[model samples]
Target: MTKPLISTERVQSSTGPMVIASVLNSPSERTSAPHRHARGQLLGARRGLLTVAAADHHWVVPATHAVWIPPDCVHGLRSHGPFHGWSVYVAAPACVDLPGQPCIIAISGLLREAVDRAATWGEGPMDQRQERIAQLLLDEIAVLPAEPLGLPLPLDPRLRRISQALADDLADNRSLAEWAQWAGLSGRTLARRFVSETGFSFSQWRQRARLLRALELLAADVPVTTIALQLGYDNVSAFIAMFRRALGVTPGRYFIAAS
Candidate 1:
């Protein structure tokens, strides 16, 4: 069973150009509200999923990915099932090379272990060996790529209503015309407005909303075929193709990487 949100003050209060690992077990809870840290944070789940949202963007994190949240970024996390994760915090000035904007970053083996080990350290400057590892971690992060894996929310109420409906059920394969009717606008007007406000056409945005829900189900060990059908895919292969296109790998491979 999950417990209440874990207190993060220990990691929050640490000093220096430091890296502190905060571990989370499976079936975890959520932060009390939107909050910020003075230092940058890399939030990753090694064994489960974490839903993180900030600045109108939301990411559903399977174990394969982590999010880079810049210093003072207001964000929050929610976990529904089991997971083993870490919150790796780095002091501000030192986090310069890392992204200032929130991003979804794929984690490599060395970086993951570095964070796992850092969880055991104290608040002072690292020893030579520790310093070496810290440098390597930063070097890896500097070159690491970011994934466009988040679903962005729109400020417009019409778009917001559609987003909410899709969040409740990703299987709604509504077309532009259908959505426009619901929004009380014509199809052409709705299409243009959606792209202008959300940077995604109605179809693209709906697909991402669906994919985000699929990710949560996938992390829970739900079968891919079932997820495909549940999300309104024509068949398993089609869903796999879409998943690969969005994630650069097939669903099975993606979940394996997460594991």
Candidate 2:
């Protein structure tokens, strides 16, 4: 569970940079409110999925994936399920040549530990070794893989109505053609608007929405088979295949590794 929203404060740290703290909760515990920060942020989700809206793009970050938010960029953070994480601040002046896009980086065991370990030390200058370690950690961040969790949904009223109906019934198993008919648009028009406005095809967006719901269900420790059925998959294997393709790991593995 998350505590109430609190004001953002920059705390003086042992090093030259200031540290900021923010808490994340499960999707059921909060609503998505978009915002940004003054300093670069290392968004760590110890559990659940984190959906971040940065600029015109939105990213769904699962466990083992962290979003590196650059300074002065507007963004929103929301929990997809029971979530616990940290927002570590790195002063902007020291950040250089960082990827400008909202990034989804795979967390190495060592880098994850460094975050905690560095936090444990008091405000002070790091020795030569610690500074080197910090630089290496930043280097790892630059190469993180971009996960394909974002699904663009158009803002058209007719399309939105149809999309909302599908969201209301994720288990409907309706094809794009069916939705197009319901929206009173041809299949080509539906596909075109989906790509033009949302940057993804109708089929791709539906799969992501289903996957997003699946991650939330899994985080709540809901049974895999049950979640598979709930998301309209014919069987657990089919769902698992989709899940692995999006995340590069199995449901069980993701859950266990996250734990």
Candidate 3:
């Protein structure tokens, strides 16, 4: 079957900005390799989960949360399942107040509607209005709160092993102590090193990792029970509770709203 998750198109807008629009067709079985973009990008996932990577940072932007990528940052986007969204690219000058860091920002109802409207506005007499809308877009964009979404993995072979292992198996169910055993270091020493290197506690790193994977699974519409099991949760309610605690809403509500 054709890959239905990523259909890419580029267009020019009256606001003197370039727009790249795409409808994600479906999720791939394997992980997405890393990549980037040229212009500043405003990205949202109308359905499913979108994993966007930039250098050491990554953001798992769900439908409720959109990511504003500054110009020229190397980034990567991976879809969990059938996903769709628009990617608006603004020139450097038009992107003032846009973030330099990878972040997840809440897409308010107004902003979301504005984006959908902007998608249909073509060049011509609409330039002035488009410019105003663009200005409003940038102004509101600056106020968006940022949230970091990935564990900072290191390049060291030993540390990299641990990172890769965690990504490969979120349900490994191994404690840091257990992991340290395989690394031939004391648990305390390993814990300190992991935190020092990644700037996140072992538990926090693990939680971020699980949330990242969970976002991907949830976007794919994988059964909640399956997602919970894959993420090492003992029950669906526990998984839902954790998701809600982290994102401030249930997964279902977020997905439906985005759609």
Model 3 lDDT, residue 41, Cα: 70
How many pairs collide in each candidate, listed in order? 2, 5, 7
Local error of candidate 1 at residue 139 (angstroms):
2.5
lDDT, candidate 3, 126-214, per-residue tens: 46677677666676678867755534665456766776677657788888999888877788877888778778787877777787677
Which parts of model 1 have CA positions greater than 4 angstroms off? Answer: 1-17, 26-32, 47-51, 55-62, 79-84, 122-128, 161-193, 212-223, 244-259
lDDT of 1 by residue, 90-160 (tens): 77767888886888877788888888777777766789888877777777677789977765667678876
The candidate 2 region of ten consecutive residues with least summed lDDT is 6-15
TM-score of each: 0.70, 0.66, 0.62
Error of 2 at 56 (Å): 2.2
Pick the lDDT winner: 1
* Candidate 3 lDDT (Cα, 0 to 1): 0.65
Model 3 per-residue lDDT at 70: 79
Superposed Cα deviation of residue 188, candidate 3 (Å): 7.0
> What TM-score does candidate 2 reach?
0.66
After superposition of all CA atoms, the RMSD between model 1 and the true structure is 4.8
**lDDT (Cα atoms) of all candidates against the true structure:** 0.72, 0.67, 0.65
